[model samples]
Target: MAKEKSVYVCSNCGQESPKWIGKCPGCGEWNTYVEEIIRKESGPKKVSTGMESVKTRPITLNEIEAADEPRIDMYDEELNRVLGGGLVQGSLVLIGGEPGIGKSTLVLQTVLRIPEKRILYVSGEESARQLKLRADRLGSASGECLIVCETSLEQIYVHIKNTRPDLVIIDSIQTISTEILESSPGSVAQVRECSASILRFAKESHTPVILIGHINKEGSIAGPKVLEHIVDAVLQFEGDQHYMYRILRSIKNRFGSTAELGIYEMRQDGLRQVNNPSELLLSQDHEGMSGVAIASAIEALGLF
Candidate 1:
């Protein structure tokens, strides 16, 4: 048997309340609560997160082994630099940006260039034909990518098991839903649960997963605050639609430094990595201008 109940959840901090409140007691945010239905099963819950369960034990610091984290070369210099060399294995990365900011284009072109590794791209926002059209327009060399349009979390896992891809990418986390939750997709609960499940899968399978997410009107990722804390890295794609230049900034990274950034130029074919940003930033036309000035800056990678 199953029992259902309604509760108010804070969208900003994921605070729960039995009734609506003017302010969230958790994060002190005003009017951030939304009603959600929770379906509770009347039985002992089982842990099926794909991670192996080991007996609880403690080890001394001297007994623990330390090793370097393994990474996969993305082949894009700017991206590689921002990620502190390359994409780390078994890492769950979240890339958030405004609409039409080239988040999907960036991920698509990256995977298309990696032909040696099997990639699984699951998109819930765009259809297969639409993705294919975008891929063709990008004009990058094809790779071993398996595209599937799925929204159900259970079905996605089934595909993951059958395909066994080296890398997995979710086009947008807001659109995915699980059957256990009665709430609609994109709700705070759904995003938190889905991302947590993906994190477990990544750690257990040693496969990297990249999740694309939407931003709220407040210019933050459109989900509970806990969503950002669950992932290993959070990359922000920033640029004005009116400008040709885009910057990939690292907000949080457990495997590397967060001070690094990647620069790119959106072109007709695809995003062209700006290896030497100073070259484009200092132009011949601007040199003659009296008001224009040039200054050297330092990034985590090197001087620019």
Candidate 2:
């Protein structure tokens, strides 16, 4: 038997309350508290009699072996730099952007170009044919990449276990729903639970998971605040949809530098990596422009 449990949680700040309130006391947000269902302990409790097992081990830090592990170099230098020289193993990255901002295109291009690893791209928003058409236009579909059109998390997990891909990309996390949550898909509760399950799977399997998420009208991730904290990195893709330029900015990174940014130019064929970003940034023939000076920063990779 399970006991009935009820609580109120703020949608904006993720604050919890024992009783319903019109305004959140912690964040001072109005009309953000929503009643949530939580399972309470109902079974009989048993007290531990004594310690059944004990083990003591001491190890010195100097005795541990250390080695410099190499990272997989990607075709795009800017992305590689933003990911701290490369994508680390067992990392979970969240990419959020507005609709039609080329988030899907960027991941698809990466999967096609990464020849060394086997990638599994699971699409919940788009069908296989639709992805194929886009892949054809971008010239990104390769033999190493596998595409699956599924929305259920259970089916996705099954495919992941059988294929054992080197990398996994989930197109838009809002569409994914778990069975444990009674709320509908895309709800605050559903999104949080689904993301947690994915995070656990990624860490336990030592596989990198790339999650695509949609942003609200306020330019933030659509789900609750906990979604951002569960992942290892949060990358915000920002740029005008009409413009050819796209910027991949890192908001949070556990294995890499957060200050790094990647810039790319969208094209009909595919995304072109911009080597010298300043060239595109500055207007042509601005040699004698007023209040403008050409500043140079010497990058360690090379002079830019």
TM-score of each: 0.90, 0.83
Question: How do the residues 54-94 of candidate 1 rate in per-residue lDDT, one tens digit apiece?
Answer: 66567999998899889999888888887888899999999
Q: lDDT tens digits, residues 234-277, model 2?
A: 99988887689988899998878899999999899978888888
Sequence-dependent TM-score of model 1 = 0.90
Off by over 4 Å in 2: 1-7, 35-70, 286-304
What Cα-based lDDT does every candidate model obtain?
A: 0.92, 0.84
Q: Which stretches of candidate 1 lie over 4 Å from their true place?
A: 43-56, 285-304
Poorest 10 consecutive residues by lDDT, candidate 1: 280-289
Best candidate, TM-score-wise? 1
TM-score of candidate 2 against the unseen true structure:
0.83
